[model samples]
Target: MTIAPSDSALAPALRGYADHKPDHLARLHKIEGQVRGLTRMVDDDRYCIDVLTQITAATHALQEVALGLLDDHIRHCVQEAVRADQDTGETKYAELTIALRRALRL
Candidate 1:
């Protein structure tokens, strides 16, 4: 159930800025390795508790990445929208609400 951004009159508040820094990329790569390790754990019939712990760590890492991106969005895009008197800020807020709901599987 992918939720794409609506193409309304409001300009998109989320724009592609600079690419991820080397450190960020390295962190993501490590997370990817962790995910692969989980797959290997399942294949090797590892204990359930161990797998669950790895999953918890992976979830935290992903959440950290998300929060960083959200902070950037609030600082740059959302702030600009509010200053320009554009509808983008409200739309962005709604988008954030939907994203949180989806992320939490609520």
Candidate 2:
């Protein structure tokens, strides 16, 4: 079997998430604000449970962003790689699995 270059090795004109990038950034910005709020909460000696709740919200927000990006990666990058060739497709799928492992902290 021949190894093929990964889709991620080359940059495409537009990424799968290109169209939704603005929305993604907006959500990230909101998460950033949530982080800043957490900082303030700690500094102000806010209740422990409240801080935990905010942390959970922030974590959930980040997870949502991640899920969106993952979906885009599969739909665009993986699909393109598979279209290129079976070897490239398999490579991309393996790469995605490793990435998911890291993301999920498994």
Candidate 3:
């Protein structure tokens, strides 16, 4: 889900990944191409192991993007919130913990 800053009072004026948004978009586009390739491979009845390998590659790429975003969030968004106030600090940290759990699939 895409949330604009206007959508939430707590939202930052600029996103954590703003500085590297272009890089992220490029990575996402590459991942999109990888997914399309995987679909084509399946349509062509390619070997099972090859398809799985491509799937793994795509998954890892996505995970890398996720990690990069997460790192940016910590360095920018969460840090700013914490520096602003104690309540916001606690809130952001809790939110970060939840996000980490979800990322880890714990």
Q: Global lDDT of each model? A: 0.73, 0.89, 0.88
In candidate 3, list every pair of residues with a backbone clash. Answer: none
Better of 1 and 2 by TM-score: 2
Which prediction has the highest TM-score against the true structure? 3
Candidate 3, which ten residues in sequence have the lowest lDDT sum? 1-10
Model 2 agreement with the true structure over 27-82: per-residue lDDT tens digits: 99999999999999999999999999999999999999999999998998889989
**Tens digit of lDDT per residue, candidate 1, span 1-106?**
3334665467565452234445566778989999999999999999999999999999899877767666666666567767776566676666667767766761
Kindly report which residue stretches of model 2 are placed more than 4 angstroms away from their true locations once superposed. 1-9
Q: Top model by lDDT, which number? A: 2
lDDT of 3 by residue, 1-106 (tens): 3222232667557788999899999999999999999999999999999999999999999999999999998998889989999877777887788789899992
Segments in model 1 whose C-alpha atoms lie over 4 Å from true places: 1-23, 103-106
Question: What TM-scores do the predictions have?
Answer: 0.69, 0.88, 0.89
